[model samples]
Target: MESPSKGYLDVGHLELGGTIQSHSSKFIPSDKAEFNRNMLSRNKIISVCLLLLVITLSGCSRINSAQGWSGILVDDDRLILASMDGHIMVLDKNTGKHMWEPDLMRVKEKDEKKRAAYGLPAVSNGILFVGVYSGKIQAVEVDTGRTVETEV
Candidate 1:
């Protein structure tokens, strides 16, 4: 008779009493344990790499927050305020009504530009010298919200 292969269950010796009487060489128990340990180490390394990737990508994303407060200037009866988004608005100090505002939407239509003002507005004669963050000085009329010139 020929011998059976190693690590194979012999079905002929299997009994209904849950006892297995067979001449079979058992499988490599130590090698199977080593393979399981290697797989666990690889799984741990992959998990750590994915966690680091998520943390690195989180800092690269942008979240919408409030813009900084601009320097407020009071000119006569009108309150000259520069918004953080780069629009200049003049309001009456008495009734808190909007006196004049620059047409930023129309200006954006002509040239797509982002305006940010952080410094104080300098008033000379009737013109206000506003320093924009884009390294430009905006000369606006104090009474009529007319833009005199933008010196780059």
Candidate 2:
């Protein structure tokens, strides 16, 4: 394989039992050094841009996935809340104590984002209905925390 030549002048030819030499008066050592410095600075700029892009994407994911806000329903003395992580929590309205263990209402689907609750819970005829971001509605008995039905 043969490699391509650069900007050097091909002024001399090789002879049998002789040496070949070439020189270009237009080339300067300082110009080569400046070219290298320019390339280095360009690489640094590109690297910093990529790093900033990664940081921005990570921050956006944290903002979207973080859990905190969810709607709550006060049914009689019990406080019913839907957690952002796809669970139903029943708490006492007055003392703020857990009425029952938090129940798993929805789960993450394959190739989908994590399940989250975004709407207020509803109670009708002693049944609590909670809607999740995964397009499912979970119904449970508000008194016993028993599962009544689920619609997906």
Candidate 3:
């Protein structure tokens, strides 16, 4: 976010330039007057563009789960969440619902330990990034919901 303290936000008056009449082009400096008009117009355009971008991007993907108070993250437009039991979930953002989740413990030994963490899930470039309690970092596909890479 930009520095909010550096900008002027007036609450004292309704009209711009503090109630100047439309036809009163009295003693305003040309450069300062042009700058004020240009800045106002530019800020309005930029604000609208930013609003549109946020709405469009936030519609991309989302994910939520019934895990034990875990966390989630966005992988590009895809959503990734994790459970305390090492289960990974992926979702489509438009609905805040899961698209896929895998039983990470299914193929492991029955005595395998579970991965748990207090940190929020992290994702990047279509890869759902996560860390296990055993010190392993894992990255999975945001689309197919498969483990694409892993490291310590």
Candidate 4:
């Protein structure tokens, strides 16, 4: 009965390395499982961040939908304003009451100027002329809210 070597061990016909190597192999599967769990956690975090970013962008778009950059126009008794949402609104100059918003183009149309107006509304002889950002000019009657002419 001779004693085994110091750095080697024999177990049931299988030979294993010293204490450090054998202990490390025992922990390898658990370490690998922990690493995989960490990777899954990181992926989940990234997905959550992307979802939050999309939600924030959608909220900003909704906030910007009703805003405009076109200059204001004051006619005889109405205050005219152009909205970036492609609407020309007429309100009472003094009371700020809602009067009318004329349709420049169909909302469901595929025109490039559907929701953008960058030019000031010009009023001449009861006719309001507006220019669309997508290269179209519309002449609308001030009082009747009728589109008199449309030029593209």
Q: Per-model C-alpha lDDT, please?
A: 0.69, 0.70, 0.59, 0.67
Q: Candidate 4 vs. truth: CA RMSD?
A: 9.9
Query: In candidate 2, what are the lDDT values of residues 127-150, reduced to their tens digit?
Result: 888776767776778877788755
Q: For residues 39-140, what per-residue lDDT tens digits would candidate 4 score against the true structure?
A: 999999999999999987886674546565587898878888876667777788999976665323321225745656667888888887777666666677
lDDT of 2 at 101: 56
In candidate 4, stretches whose alpha carbon ends up further than 4 angstroms from where it belongs are 1-66, 101-109, 112-115, 150-152
RMSD of each: 10.5, 10.7, 16.7, 9.9
**Rank ordering of all candidates by lDDT, starting from the highest:** 2, 1, 4, 3
- Measured with C-alpha atoms, the lDDT of residue 5 in candidate 4 is 53
For model 3, give the 10-residue run with minimal summed lDDT. Answer: 103-112
Residue 8 CA displacement from its true place in model 1, Å: 70
Instruction: Quickly count the clashes in candidate 2.
Output: 0
* Candidate 1: stretches off by over 4 Å: 1-62, 101-114, 150-152
* Model 4 worst lDDT window (10 residues): 19-28
Best by lDDT: 2
In angstroms, how far off is 31's CA in candidate 4?
63
lDDT (Cα) of model 4: 0.67
| Candidate 3 structure quality by residue, lDDT tens digits, 47-68 | 9999999987776534443346
Which has the better lDDT: candidate 3, or candidate 4?
4
